[model samples]
Target: MSISASPKSRLLITHVLDFNSIFLFKAQVSRQSLGVLRDMKAAIYPITRPTIGRKKIPFRPYNTFPSGLKAEVVTFDE
Candidate 1:
């Protein structure tokens, strides 16, 4: 997937399948990118509930850094 703010700025994403069967995603920012891409700061929110009939859903803050990547596996019991 590729996300772009303009013709010169873009975030390129590539997916790789490892030998362990885990999917790894890699992202690269173009050299001419500006703003958020240049700063490399992003907020990610994971939805824990269904939003079918909800008017508002709380956002859980997840921080991302340029130094490294973090991955989490969550399981819910019904």
Candidate 2:
């Protein structure tokens, strides 16, 4: 399964964690769909720093996003 980001979602890409997420994400994304991020200076970062849950759970297990891509939320482009 691929992880996709969209304006409809409240979650945003903070960093890249792994290759699996990136490959799956890219696989699901089409050439036309990539225009939205590529031209917007999207970037990937890792999430292994353990910053989730607002640091409320110090002992919580955090998965690393070795390949998370960030994109701009463009409106009226459709």
Candidate 3:
């Protein structure tokens, strides 16, 4: 899909591997389409859990990925 296309036009990424806490994904888009793949950095925070009223705390596992790509985390490192 073209870069100008909407988010839905993004290629499907079925596999996502957390390489030593860094997320790396493979897209359905062929290499010939984009020529070269670039690594993207992003933040992936943990889900916040409810708690008593007090100072708020940040989450962990802040990961990143390419923008405008549609992917599913089929498997990941623990």
Using TM-score as the measure, the top candidate is 1
Alpha-carbon RMSD to native, per candidate: 17.8, 15.7, 17.9
Better of 1 and 3 by TM-score: 1
- TM-scores, each model vs. reference: 0.18, 0.16, 0.15
> Where in model 3 is the C-alpha error above 4 Å?
1-27, 36-72, 75-78
Compared with the true structure, model 2 gives a TM-score of 0.16
Error in Å for residue 78 of model 2: 27
Give me the overall lDDT of model 3.
0.28
Off by over 4 Å in 2: 1-27, 40-78
Summing lDDT over every window of 10 consecutive residues in candidate 1, give the lowest-scoring window: 50-59
lDDT of 3 by residue, 1-78 (tens): 576432212122222543323323333433333332242221132322222221111222334333211122333111
Error of 3 at 73 (Å): 1.5
Worst 10 residues of 3 by lDDT: 50-59
Q: Which candidate is the best by lDDT?
A: 3
Clashing pairs in 1: none
How close to the true structure is residue 78 of candidate 3, measured as C-alpha lDDT? 19
